[model samples]
Target: MTILDKYILKRYLITFAVMIMLFVPIGIMANLAEQIGKMIDNEAPVNEILIYYGNFTIYIGSLLFPIFLFLSIIFFTSKLASNTEIVAILSSGVSFARFLRPYLIGASIIAVLMFLMAMFIVPKASAGFNEFKYKYLKRGREDRVTTNIFTQLNETDFIYVSSFNPARKSGNNFTFERFNKDNQLDFKISANMIRWIEKDSTYRLTSYQKRKLRGNREIMETKRRLDTVFNFKIDDLTPVSYVAETKDLFELNQFIEDQKKKGASNINAYKLVKYKRWALPVSAFILTIIAVAVSSIKRRGGMGVNLAFGIFVAFIFIFFDKVFGTLAEQAGFSPLLAVIIPNVFFGVLALYLLQNAKR
Candidate 1:
């Protein structure tokens, strides 16, 4: 690389490294404080807690790096302007856009790293983090837990559980109903309690009742014990207790597919999750541009003012992100649109600001 390239790169690297070191430990400490009590209450061992926090750090660091990189660029580039170094470069016949070459190069590197973290590393780590939380920190397990969870396994059937306990391998107050092509309930099954035998992969239900329709008549009968296994898999039970972020991308994708087949109504939630994983990394690029453009120009008010402005802009970005995401899910906008819409708008804003900065 040229001397100028090496010099600029060195400055950016120093600033980026400092911000990362500062942010990562704070992120770790904040997470540890929030989760440590839960782990202790759950009787988790120290080693397990350590491992959990280590995995959490990887996840947090991956997410925090892009914002830190953006802030670092702003900090150092603003310093260059305040000290008249940029003016010196301009007087030496270097174009402002040409001067941005090193910053863009650094941003490109960060973008690739962010993409890798979002697509591959973060998802895998999330699995471990979530497993630790569910197995150790959560209130109960999927099979031995008590929850009233619902999901559509297909379009025709809506499944419901009034209450289930993993320890008993059973559920109480359960109902599964199927509606006909005309949206009329053709069959319904209500059971007082349902139990599972892991060794045989079957459920032994108690106080079971079946209601059959005969073209305008209803037939209902009750039984004391019924031994049968439903079509649903044991793996399906996990999603009942976990949120979308707790599942990896592949898990989320499979969940949406399974739910769709079962006629699930909440596939949009999974779709939003899938879109968000990539959208978050792409947002780093736009935020980086905005940070660079905003701080590359010197002001009489100095670096502190610039830093405050950056913080405000960051908050605004996050606020809009959540707002638009809610609108996307509740208002029935496309999941892809919900995730990318803010980024698109902010990207244009960044571009306009950069153009004005160049002038």
Candidate 2:
């Protein structure tokens, strides 16, 4: 790297580290406050609370890094501008675009890192953290579905699960029912014990009973020793929300496909979530460019004014993010548009400012 590149990189890295350091304490303090109630209510021990808050800060930090990145770029670049160091470099025949080479490289690395964390790392941590919260911090727990729960698979299907011991591969009192599209009773099948057959991805129901309903009278009933293959498994009935966010992207796609097959309604939220998973990572790059473009302009009001303006611009991005997300969920707007609108708008603004900066 050239000396100028190293110089710019040093400033950017220092700003990034400073921003993270400042936010880390704020996050820890906020986590401590949240856990205070949990510690009091559940009488959680110090070590357990410490672990929980530690994970909490990491999770929050992962989400907040993009915002911090935006702030850091503004902080350092504004300093450079106000000090006329950028002017000196321009006068030295260094093109503004050439100076941006290091910044763009740094931004790309951070963006890719953010994408990897959001896609893979955050999911695993979030799963463990959520599990801990459910076990220790939750109050008035709902009885999770287990053995002997009568659950509805869909609008036209009823399942009576007598016993489903998830740990053991055995379940008793299994009944599967399906109705016609017109809501007419089609057929009912009952079984003694159902075992999940993993190799073929099917269910094995042993010692079953079949009843064919015929116009509410004179239905054929038969009993038989049977090993049958069925598509739906015991795990199919798991509440979708119980799944972790990390798994949500893949699962939501599968779910939307399954729902389409089953003719279900209201998958907008899942659609939004899926788009958001990709959108958030790319946002780091766009927001960084926007931050630099906005703050690099020389102003009489100095760094404080530029900092305030940066905060305002960041809030605008965040506000639109929430607003578009809500609209996507409620009105079924194109998830791609909902997620990308802010980036597109900010990209245009960045280009406009950068052109003026070059002039």
Best by lDDT: 1
Full-model lDDT for every candidate: 0.75, 0.74
Off by over 4 Å in 2: 45-47, 141-176, 179-185, 188-211, 214-244, 248-266
RMSD of 2: 7.4
Candidate 1: lDDT over CA atoms?
Answer: 0.75
For candidate 1, list the clashing residue pairs, or say none.
143-166, 144-166, 144-167, 145-166, 153-262, 153-263, 154-262, 154-263, 155-263
How does model 2 fare in lDDT?
0.74
Model 1: per-residue Cα lDDT over 59-150, one tens digit each = 77875675677678789888988998878887898887787777777777777777767766776776677778787777564422246657
- Give each model a TM-score: 0.81, 0.74
Where does model 1 exceed 4 Å of error?
141-188, 192-204, 211-221, 234-252, 329-333
The sequence of per-residue lDDT tens digits that candidate 2 reaches over residues 243-322 is 43646456657766765444333346656666777877677767777777777778999999988988898889889888
Ten contiguous residues minimizing lDDT sum, candidate 2: 237-246
**Alpha carbon lDDT of residue 161, candidate 1?**
74
